[model samples]
Target: MERALKRYWPIFILPTLLAFLIGFIVPFVQGLYLSFCQFTTVNNAKWVGLSNYIKVFKDTTFTDAMKFTIAFTVVSVILINVLGFAIALALTRKLAGTNIFRTVFFMPNLIGGIVLGYIWQILINCVLSIVGEPLLALNTQAGYWGMIILTCWQQIGYMMIIYIAGLQNIPDDLIEAAQIDGASSWTTLWRIKLPMVMPSITICMFLSLTNGFKLFDQNLALTAGEPYHSTEMLAYNIYNTFYARAGAQWKGIGQAKAVIFCIIVVAISMIQLKATRSKEVQQ
Candidate 1:
């Protein structure tokens, strides 16, 4: 098998390489090019250089979206990772019906973003109706909190499974050694368990961070950045720039925004990966 893989590596790689060129690399290069040009179609792109980028910064709505997105991401990442790790700790205990609880928790993650959005919207509205106002009308604070709750609820379960796997992989010998040293539970968790699970922590953090930054479907279906567009995030802002308004100018600007977003997300993920990878302990 090893000899076959080595001898026929090109054959195995070629199909996927071609598919990547077609599906990703080609479009990625084109999209970056489109960011600097103004056109209704790719073929007709007329180079406008930095004008779109300038417009992106000039738009206060885009700025607001950036702020909202960052705040949402911070809140969501904390809640998702902390709650997930806690649940993982709970489930890792040899408890009855643990499997059933895990299944119930993770089931929310499998639901479509749009469906979850509507469900949450209905639930929030039901509560808000008692006070005689809609969810969006309640203000930016409500929208912000709502989105955070929605994100955390959906993401925690998935993250929990990752943490659970990480916890289980910590060798029993290490725990016994720590116990022999007269370490308390908190001490062991902070010094031993956490260090051992750094890989899992990195994965969970990256997943939560990236997902928070790139979130769109739920943002769209839940708030749609409504009530004077107070809740607009980066993705929805880009969408509105391209399609909601009249003119090709915003389309080019949207492309520029998207390219910027891509750079931001990629750069952050890389930095986080590097930072966490350094701390990961060997088994």
Candidate 2:
């Protein structure tokens, strides 16, 4: 069986490799090239060198979006992981109706991002109407918090599930041993459970970080970066630059922003993974 599998591995891998080259690698290379050229379409690309990047750096809207996205990612990553881990801890404690609770909590994650955005927008607007605020679109602070709340609500449950799996995988003997050693519950959790769950933490943090960075549909549907574009995030900013602007130069600038976005995300994700993985203990 091992011999058969090894012999046929390349045959099975070839299609996927080809598809990846066609779907991702090709477009990625092309996008990198287009970032240095001005063009309305791929066929008409004209080399403009680093002027696109220069424009990207000079654009105040892009700078604001970059700052906004970083802030949002930082806040969301902290909230989602802390809340998700707390909920996972609670649900794993043999509480009554835990299955039902899990299902209820996780159901929000199944909803589409666009749908969740619209739903929250209506709910938030209804509440704000009582106080005579215009709407989420008109209040930058409110829109910022609304996006944070919506992201946390949608993501926490999914992260909780991952934490639960990590919690469950912990050996009963180790926990019992800690108890036998007169360790308090807090001590046991800090010394044993958390270290054991570091793998889950890594995964959750990576997901949350990347999701926060790449978020667009929710940003679009929720606030649409209203109130003079104060709430626009990097992804939405790039998108608007690509399609909403009048001239061909904007496309190259947008592509440059995308490349920068990709680099930031990848670099941050790699650093996070390395930091978390170092803390993880072998079972």
TM-scores of the candidates in the order shown: 0.97, 0.98
Give the RMSD in angstroms, all C-alphas superposed, for model 2.
Answer: 0.9
- Assess the local accuracy of residue 125 in candidate 1 as a C-alpha lDDT between 0 and 100: 77
lDDT of each: 0.91, 0.96
Tell me the TM-score of model 2: 0.98
Question: Relative to the unseen true structure, what is the C-alpha lDDT of residue 166 in candidate 2, on a scale of 0 to 100?
Answer: 99
Shift of residue 62 alpha carbon in model 2, Å: 0.6
- Please give the clash total of every predicted structure, in order: 0, 0
